[model samples]
Target: MAAGTLYTYPENWRAFKAQIAAQYSGAALKVASTTPAFTFGQTNRTPAFLQNFPLGKVPAYQGDDGFCLFESNAIAHYLSNEALRGATPQAAAQVLQWVSFADSEIIPPASTWVFPTLGIMQFNKQATEQAKEDVKRALTVLNQHLNTRTFLVGERISLADITVVCSMLWLYKQVLEPSFRQPYNNVNRWFITCINQPQFKVVLGEVKLCEKMAQFDAKKFAEMQPKKEAAPKKEKAPKEAAKPQEKKEKKKEEKKEEKKPAPEEDMDDCDAALAAEPKSKDPFAHLPKSTFVMIEFKRKYSNEDTLAVAIPHFWDNFDKEGYSIWYSQYKYSDELTLTFKSCNLITGMFQRLDKLRKNAFASVILFGTDNNSSISGIWVFRGQELAFPVTDWQIDYESYDWRKLDSDSEECKTMVKEYFAWEGDFKHVGKAFNQGKIFK
Candidate 1:
């Protein structure tokens, strides 16, 4: 009976809950995503949006009668039929329990693990492994609960089933490969059943699970974040007390040494650095290409043994005279606010350095959350000299401070092992680990 308009990002699993609810209830739910209805980021920032949904997070619903709702669960419950919600008080509480379980028990680790694979956020291997285990446990519980029943609550499909299925949406599609998920047989069966329902199928067209789990793509994650225009450099305020002779000397020096790029060219260089270009080709053109395939090493690091085998193999077969190891850290940690935003900035920087990826390996980490975070990375690139110079990457390269890491030192060995494995106590920053973005 709840007729309204819903505003949320496309393919958002949260919004899918409300949409599926509307489909079953025969409610008039107009989705406002593009053009005359709504434009994300722009419209959501407007006064009207804030007035209706004070929280401003999506799956926001506003009915013609002026009833407004925020949060997916609230919007979903508002739109559902009495049968779906539950006919009795006890059943309704039971439905609410599953919904709460999904939000609290499932989402935290799910977002940490799957968001990176979707290129929405960064990855932390330790956090991801913990998430995989946490998810398996949650599914084990659900699988046991669903082993007998066809639906989560009662005999028919209910809001509990819809909420839990949508909650598992991204995990199944992004990180839950068959081999990883084979243990949760009943959970998989329930998920397929819930999604195949007419209402669910209408909102969620088709569900595709990962064949072989995809690792983080630093380039894609960085490029996916909305681009922020570089703020113009503010000219320093004139020194009110400077003598006439001093001003004249400064002006003369500025003319002699201050050759600034044109505004268009400045932007062009920054853009070109990230974009593919014909300016430079084959950075290793001077040296013979190493017979040791970097890809094989990467596969080993990703899937096979890392510290025990891969790193040793890397050193054993390393083109030591050709490749060099370097430690790189963001110089603007003081400017990073919000853990998520800081991670995104690092991702963007790595994306801008995509050309160097083939020549490089890095594990950049964010140390804290909002206003207290720092970004530092360990990089191993194809050449002895920094790979960014005389190339497109130089535009963003200046933003970082780089130090050559000695590949021979025991300390360097530890750093490479810890950072590359995405585990171990990171002794560098001396803070609890937050998350990491891989520049592979």
Candidate 2:
């Protein structure tokens, strides 16, 4: 029996394989994934841990007798019982074959497709679509092979089944929605059977299949971006050297301006005048000034109680003539995957639309759990038309279906109150509120 300690992160699908093997083999496997026992980033970087597992990746293992092992597959194989290793030489080779199949065929495409949905990786449309094809091919292979057999290599479950199932865990949980995975019926049946087993259940608990395919979340990718420190201010150039460069830049600008064509002699005075005048870049500059101060309302919403102060202030001071209320729903609800990722999408949109903050406010909400969710929000815009006047705001805006709401209608008020308060029946959403984000 292999009695040892496994070093890994919590809920790591890689570590689950070794833990599942230990369960079946009756090995004493103590998982060190939390504080005191182990701290992932810190512990893995330490010289002591690095000496045993040179690669520093997990699930690394240290046996009771000081036998050190690294790589999840190697550790899992070490912990597996004779039956799981396969009874005969031929069976052992078959087990190895299936294990290799899982790693080479299943994991790559699975990770490529699932990581983006979890917000762990940047999404590429072509790559993801190809990955879906690859996943289908891998599942098709498994579906055909498992058509008559109870397990991959032998009559009973073995390392092959364990490895393959662990490798496919994320794909099944995040992207393999019912309609998408319907073709692989045999693989599905086998997967359910393996997961429901005592050994697998001990490590994975109750596995939930994905009800809806998850999409790439831009918000998560943005949050994951590294925030670099500001560079030190550069010393000013010598005055004499700067003067000549400044004069040269000014002359270049003057020459460019002088090269402009004169307005057509026959052109109308209004048309020529309008053409000659420089256009202001501000999108909302054309809109009439409103009595409602967006900045003040934003402050109240942030600093005071929503129901008691903010909601009342909004209704009392709302400038319906100068502004408009609109309901926006994400067009691709069926493609939404994880709750956190969906929330990130909202955050990403808010960040990109920072320029629109002075003219607009919104309360976007994500509803439901991973693999089944929707996104919708109430927006206040400075003008009667949609607030996105320029292309920058149009990026994420076009993805949503926008509807102008009657500002004085009770139903609109009720929806706005619920969104602003981050609570309400939200009956139209047909899902429980998971989280919300504010654009101010």
Candidate 3:
């Protein structure tokens, strides 16, 4: 029998653990609940319980080997390897990538945007707006990438898709109304496909799409209020009694005089005067053309030593408005070379820059080749200069240069701008990287 027991509340914490349980149905993974039936603080916080998992957080795991793990992602990873590492190394790597992406990219905004709107989390109008924008931007990235592909990381369903889909469950259940999701047709399609998977269906039994909650409807509600009393109608006088027939004939004569057309000379003069007026130039003609730049990085990663140090520095000093970061990987090679180790590495880089959480946003993409096997894209920052400090992991100063391109340079500017606007071909690199191990 498998040696570990997983403990978590039923619905709140189930999704994260569900991925593993679904993958490893018979893998001796006992789920201990801390819900109403088995309260954590009320009854399960005994020394024995504390010893097994000190954090007291639901979803903690205690292994038969006596190893305890906290954090959903960590436990899910362990369970997944033992339960569902797939038939090949490449499949395993894709799973890791998607799982990391879910934790990093999806959860943050979900916590920030969806929860608040649902009243599950405190609502701050300003914060919610920002969160909405962030999520929209992130989803846009995902939708574009998903335009051509099916799963989060590869052709097949893996832990990555499972993880991300689980995180999104809450949004679908509470916030993704048809109005909101209509713009994200691809995301909706991919989500539907994922939820329909046998394992996903088993884990998320009878999951239903939620109707969007109206933000506020006080005015409309008020307008629908019933009137206290009926309004009195005003009486009208009879037409025959109101005016005499002779007076009506005189009124008709006056109307006839008014109906006579002005002379042709007067009409022609009016047309001539109107035709003399000058046309105005378009108001927006002089507006400065927006410029963009695409900074491509395509170096090979043999070991962590060369690029590890530089990535963090670049993230720290990265210019937020002047540049945008799109995490890119060779698509096909991504499912191949992307291992749990690499996923953790990417996650670490993102975490190191966590301080820029609000100031800057980042995303990842998986492209399908290895020769130009570039994990590269553009950063649309606010200024002409690349203000962000280069990290030790970065190859060389010359390798990553940011420049202002001609607005007319469609080829260069559009791709970079698309990365920022969350438009174009790159798929959403999942959010798992956001929570994965970060370099100090």
Candidate 4:
């Protein structure tokens, strides 16, 4: 069995391939991603790390016996057992073919389609549309191939499945909503099957499929730009002193060249930019400090009974003067198809509004069955103003119609009780409660 340490950043899908392979093969693989072991830019750029992995890109690997490898495919291949590599020469060749396909075919379009949504790349409408078509084409090919097969290569899971799944992970999670993925049923089934396996699950925890397709957020994109450093003041030396200084600098440069290290290579421009980016100012910093604690309510809602305990706590502690209640309903309910997809819309919205959770609490629910449903939710915000209009939480808010509710009104109380409890008759929605997701 191969025993080694893998160096990479956390949640890096590329590193997942080798980790999953190691799990299946029972290889003793140690990950060095966190502090003290490895830190992305600092650790990877170190002289010791660059000596082993010259390019400094990851997921790089170094074995106990001194064998070292870079490039995700190479590392995964090295870590795989014969069963994962292939059972025969032809099987191994086929595995290589699929791995190459994942790199050449899936990655480009996947990165282009998914990066902008991640706020790592600038959005270009024309380029994004093309990437969508390209992704569809790739999925169509996989769908056809997987129509009669459970796995990609043989009767069992192999490196081929791992590579392709990792390559498509971001795509499935960010853009491949149910409607867009409906045509590629076989691909969807195979992808789901692969991810659910013990090996894949060990590497990738619960993989939530995209409910609503993500869009490039101009606010998030702008926030990712590196903070500009102030330019240093320039000082000029005397005309005669300049020549002696230049010769001294040339001598210093020549001596330094003798011990020069490997050139630092840029890998994943977005990752580098994100590391250098500054923390954003809190959007709700100007709001008055409310006595209501959003986290405490969320904790009770999660752990305690909703109707008997959590609901009462919400009503008792809700600061009417400091906080405001609002009702939001999806404007395009007619376009919502699958129930799961509708739920995904709620999930996606909650994810985008993560920053708002400190000052907000919401019960966004999906109503009715597949092909016939409505989405409506009760939102509690720290201030009277519409939070989304004034904050960066505007990504999905425009998709829903918002109305400020009178906190003292009986109608508002009923809506809050039902939404928070997730069981009351939603007469306003006119549909049965299918599922609910909370944002706090």
Best by TM-score: 1
Better of 2 and 4 by TM-score: 4
How far in Å is the alpha carbon of 404 misplaced in model 3? 40
Per-residue lDDT over 282-373 for candidate 3, one digit per residue giving the tens place of the 0 to 100 score: 33234333332222111111112223432333434444444443323333333434343343444345544432332333443323232222
> TM-scores for all candidates?
0.56, 0.53, 0.46, 0.55
Predict model 2's lDDT versus the native. Answer: 0.80
Q: How accurate is candidate 3 locally (lDDT)?
A: 0.51
Where does candidate 3 stray beyond 4 Å? 1-3, 13-15, 19-21, 34-37, 81-91, 214-440
List candidate 1 segments past 4 Å from native: 226-440
- Per-candidate total of colliding backbone pairs: 1, 0, 43, 0
lDDT tens digits, residue span 14-79, model 2 = 889999999999999999987889866557768999898886677789999999998889999999
Q: How do the residues 267-367 of candidate 4 rate in per-residue lDDT, one tens digit apiece?
A: 35335734443456777788778888887887677556778888899989999878899999999978988764676578567755655766888887777
Q: Kindly list the per-residue Cα lDDT of model 1 for residues 291-366, writing each as its tens digit.
A: 6677667656655566787788887887777788888777887887766456557656766665665677777777
For lDDT, candidate 2 versus 3, the one ahead is 2
Candidate 2, poorest ten consecutive residues by summed lDDT: 263-272
Write down the lDDT that model 1 would get: 0.75
Q: Which ten residues in a row have the lowest lDDT in candidate 1?
A: 261-270
